[model samples]
Target chain A: AQSVTQPDIHITVSEGASLELRCNYSYGATPYLFWYVQSPGQGLQLLLKYFSGDTLVQGIKGFEAEFKRSQSSFNLRKPSVHWSDAAEYFCAVGGANAGGTSYGKLTFGQGTILTVHP
Target chain B: DTAVSQTPKYLVTQMGNDKSIKCEQNLGHDTMYWYKQDSKKFLKIMFSYNNKELIINETVPNRFSPKSPDKAHLNLHINSLELGDSAVYFCASSHPQVRGGYTFGSGTRLTVV
Candidate 1:
């Protein structure tokens, strides 16, 4: 079984300040990680995904995450956050063997809600 | 056009009244899925269909059923709606290889009153 844990339930950051959301996962096989953002009353939008590549992967809206194997972490980071960045962030992990089917399904963490202040 | 779309974005109905949520994906993906997000924001998979065939069925109750008419549409039908069934239902689609991850719909918020 695979699981993801996001320690922070709520995060507050001022505009123009750097932000980092921590995500940790436990998977027995090769893990495919993903970050998704959701606004209030809206659907989830993919921020980025890590399958197999450079540890640092860049995503839209000036977001990036690094996959740390030894630490079992894939933390999302941004140099500076904007006011519009206030949303709920979710971290998910799944083991996609050679077949690309999630061992069963993707496991998601308790989302972290971001509140960007002026 | 929305790649993945769901109908009845906001549905409010009395308890015990059955309802259905429709989902369609324009993307040429081979797989479609249904997920439920509880009030506390925990997401769990309910069902998954691949190539119009049911592939994954979680421990959901028999009252909750998913119907995939074709490869591009998967609809959720809930019978004897209970208060516990009130939540945001999301529809998603993806290719088998995890190419670009999955595409999600705008979600339908079901309120059982």
Candidate 2:
């Protein structure tokens, strides 16, 4: 079974400050990790995803995440946060089976609500 | 064009009534999924279909049925809607091993009165 845990339920960061959201996962095999943001009344938008290789991956909206295999974590980071970056963040894990029948059956963690302070 | 689109973005109905939510993906992905986001913001997969074939069905109650008519559409119908069923339902599609293939539709907020 695969699962994800986001330790921060709510995080408040001042605008222009750096931000990091912690995510930990448990999977027996090579895991596919992703970060998604959902604004108020909007659907989820993929921030970044880690399939394989390259511990550091860059995503849209100036967000990036580092995949640390030893730590079993893929934490999202932003050098400088913007006010519009406030949203619900979710850490998810999924995998592609060898047969390739299904994918994106993600196991998501409890979302973290990000609040940007002016 | 919206890659993944769900109908009736907002739905409110009385308990014991039945309703359906329709979903379609124009991205040409063969796999589609349904997920439920509870009030606490915990998301869980409900069902998944591949090319109109049922592939994954979680512990969802039998009252909540999923139907995939074709490769592009997956519909969810709830019989005797209950208060507990009031939550946001999301439809997503993705192709295995394809970068940037996964896409999610604007969720349908169902409020059971």
Top DockQ hit = 2
| DockQ (0 to 1) for model 2 | 0.60
Give RMSD to native, each candidate. Answer: 1.4, 1.3
Instruction: Look at candidate 2 and give me any clashing residue pairs.
Output: none
**Model 1 pairs in collision:** none
Which window of 10 residues has the lowest lDDT sum in candidate 2 chain A?
A: A96-105
| Candidate 1 lDDT by residue in tens digits, A1-118 | 7899999999999999999999999988778899999999999999999989798999999999999999999999999999999999999987676664552367799999999999
What TM value does chain B of candidate 1 have? 0.97
Please give me the DockQ of candidate 1 compared with the native complex: 0.58
Q: Write the per-residue lDDT of candidate 1 for residues B17-51, one digit (tens) a residue.
A: 98999999999988899999999999999998998
How does chain A of every candidate compare to the true chain A by TM-score?
A: 0.94, 0.95
Candidate 1, residue B108: how far the Cα is off, in Å: 0.5
